[model samples]
Target: MDQITNDLKKSLESNDAYCLSELSTLFSDRALTDGPHINEDLNTCYGGVLNELHNVACLNGNEVWTSGDKDNIYLYNLKGDILKDFQTSSTSCIQDIAVTQSGQLLYTDDNNRSVNIVSNTQIDTLIKLNEWIPHGVCIASSGDFLVAMTSVDWDHTNVVRYSGSTEKYSIQWDDQGQPLFPAGYTTKYLKENKNLDICLADPDARAVMVVSAARKLRFKYTGSSSSITLKEPFYPSGITTDNYSKILIADMCNQIIHIVDKNSHFLRYIKNYNLRSPRGLRVDSKDNLFVAECYTGRIKKIQFYR
Candidate 1:
């Protein structure tokens, strides 16, 4: 039995496909846990250094990259001190921002029709699009990044995966041949769940769409019908997933953060800490949620999980 186990291990390690499949299943076994009875407010960092806090990307411990309706992106610590600031290559406003596992900063330049990376304070065009204008971006666990883009005419929208600068595939339509995402220039935030599910927060559709890693339609979570406080229509903007595979989405119009399970089950609502027009959501390695309030220009850090 020992020899057989060793042989099996060697075989798995030798095959990348088997190793990745096993690793994915191993991680998915960890189920989501119920959050704390009352979430704690950690700190509030002023992102008003920009015009408006549009998005946030977790860089490392207690540090995050923030962007607004401008070409410049600022890096700030939780203490509200600006660590670094860099401007995009294009003069137009940045659509979204994300940080790679290696701590590299990436942002979408819709006007330039490209995705760029910031290295050593220099901007490098990583992926250039001819027909689609990139908006939202997120780095997957596999190091591949996903970009949500709309066509030049703003008549079509989809999420495309890229391995470095090479296009792997795209998730555009459902099994029924219907569009997976709504068309338009509306912002669509993308994040990969622990279960390898591609979750997108589409504000134009007024729904949070979750698809399998293979691009299969898993589920769509509209707002909770039973909630009394959610008087406005569901307008999901920024999206993120925690260590427990729990998904959190920012509802800008309602000023609430909705938490859902990997299966799209409504878990709870985070409406504390005076979340005024929360537009971007990001969770750190420690499970601390950093919310970017658009109009307020503030980033609120909260410990929602116990």
Candidate 2:
């Protein structure tokens, strides 16, 4: 343990990019805690400004960016006040939205087949694909962009990694040469776990698929039948991970959030919060979860961990 700490300190002092997965492994014992339990509700931001809220991205500790079936994105505070409203470069609605570590907003425009970044009200096109339509996007700890895309014909789907508009690689198949994600125009949301695992919520498959940093198949969580409160089919819509590497998935059909460990072990279900069609999820630095309700058009703030 001392040696590992010394090595991490040296890497930090040198200002070089370090592997978060290695750190997570080294500190797994210390990071592990009791099962997560929900605390009192913190706040709720009314998203009625949008016709139907679909996605929510944490901008900072006190602010979040929201989008619906429109080309505009609104930034709101915990008090439900709009801080700023920005429109996408294309007239199409935003498929998904994510915030970078540096606080910049990134969104996907499937209609234009482009990925754009919003900085100080100026929208710049970062990536433009020919046959693939961008659906969901998230920023990895390595400063790379992981985008979920569907083919032009909507028959195939995959996740691609990009570094400043340059294609790095893609994760589409498993070791057995089978497609990892379901096909068609289904909504697929993804995020990078603290262990450097790519976690995706696929509603069509009704499962949460996770892949290691090496792009190997880790596990697939297809909802638990033991839970009496969870509805019949598990419909995972949005996904996010906390500092402890716990995967939080939004179950759209059940109207609850499912919590799982890094190894795909079912932890618990958050069903007490008056969740109504929880579609998108985002966790702040403090593990505060922000859930976007599709029908209610509201963003609820939840504290599920100490």
In candidate 1, stretches whose alpha carbon ends up further than 4 angstroms from where it belongs are 1-50
How does each model score on lDDT? 0.80, 0.81
* Per-residue C-alpha lDDT of model 2 across residues 85-137, encoded as one tens digit per residue: 97676677789999987789999998899999989898999998999999889
In candidate 1, what are the lDDT values of residues 173-291, reduced to their tens digit? 88899998888668888998866688889988999888877677779998875655587999998899987778899998888888887777787888755778899888888787888
Best by TM-score: 2
Instruction: Find the 10 residues in a row with the least total lDDT in model 1.
Output: 14-23
Q: How close is candidate 1 to the true structure, as a TM-score?
A: 0.86
Clashing pairs in 1: none
Clashing pairs in 2: none
Candidates' RMSD to native: 4.8, 4.3
Which candidate achieves the best lDDT against the true structure? 2
lDDT of 2: 0.81
